[model samples]
Target: MTLALTRDELAEYLHEVFPQIRDDFAIDDLSPERITMRLLTAERHLRPGGTVSGPSMFALADVAVYAMVLARIGKKALAVTTNCSLDFMRKPEAGRDLIAECRLLKLGRVLAVADVLMFSEGGTDPVARASMTYSIPPA
Candidate 1:
């Protein structure tokens, strides 16, 4: 499938539709099958041990897949996650932003599945991995 939205357009749409989290995520790159997103880590994203929190990483994964789905499906604000499985492999560095690379595993008429790999900025090893399923609203 072709991409329905460019990176700039997607960013604008996200800001207009989801203002609460618009500032938290940045689209690094986008394609028909994959999207790379960055979580602009702040102090509020850190946990008690001064490491990036699980919730923060989960948010990154969720948004990454959401962006991927939107990239192909256009501005479908109602597309909602139906299932999510996440694995935390290592602790994320508090000083570095988190990057989530999401690949669309399946995109059907009513369902979309994506796998996300998350890493700390400038790090080679992945910090977390996620699989998410989104239910698309009927056209």
Candidate 2:
């Protein structure tokens, strides 16, 4: 499908719909099938060992997919996560932002599925992975 929203429009819509997380994520890139997002890691995003926290990584995965959906479908803030499977692998590198690369596996009328791979900024290996399914709002 063609894009319903451009990258800038998607970013604006995300900020309008989710002000609470607006500062935490940045849309680095966008395409028809994939989105690249960055988590602006801060002290609050780190664990005791200074690595990015699991919950923070999960948030990146969640928002990245959500953004991807909105980019394709336009402003559907009601779309919600119906299911998620997440795996934490290695510790994230210290003092760097976290990056999540997400691809939409399915974008049906009622549901959307996304696969995400997360890594510390500039790192080659993934630190976490997630698969998320979202329930799209009926038109």
Candidate 3:
């Protein structure tokens, strides 16, 4: 499918809808099948051991897929995650940003499915992987 929103537009829409997390993520790239996003990791994102927390990684995955869906379907803030399966493969590198590469698997009328791979910035191996299903709001 063709893009309905550009990278800048998606970022703006996200900031408008989710102001609380407006500064947490950045759009790295946007494409028909995939979207790349980065989470600017900070002290607040870390756990007791100085590693990035699981919830922080999960947020990256969720937002990456959410942005991908909006890129193809336009601004639909009501579209929400229906199910998510995440695997923490390895501990994320400390003091590094996290990158989430989200691939759209299916974009149906009511449901959208995507897979996300998250890695510490500049890392070769993934730190986490996620499969997510989103419930799209009717137009």
RMSD of each: 0.6, 0.6, 0.6
**Candidate 2: where is the Cα deviation over 4 Å?**
none
Ranking by lDDT: 3, 1, 2
TM-score of each: 0.98, 0.98, 0.98
C-alpha RMSD of candidate 2 = 0.6
How would you encode candidate 3's per-residue C-alpha lDDT over 23-50 as one tens digit per residue?
A: 7999999999999999999888999999
Q: List the global CA lDDT of all models.
A: 0.94, 0.94, 0.95
Off by over 4 Å in 1: none
Q: What is the lDDT of residue 13 in candidate 1?
A: 92
Q: Which ten residues in a row are the worst by lDDT in model 1?
A: 16-25
Writing each residue's lDDT as its tens digit, candidate 1 over 62-122 gives 9999889999999999999999999999998879999999999999999999999999999
Clashing pairs for model 1 are: none
Of models 2 and 3, which has the larger lDDT? 3
Task: Give the Å error, residue 50, model 1.
Answer: 0.7
TM-score of 2: 0.98
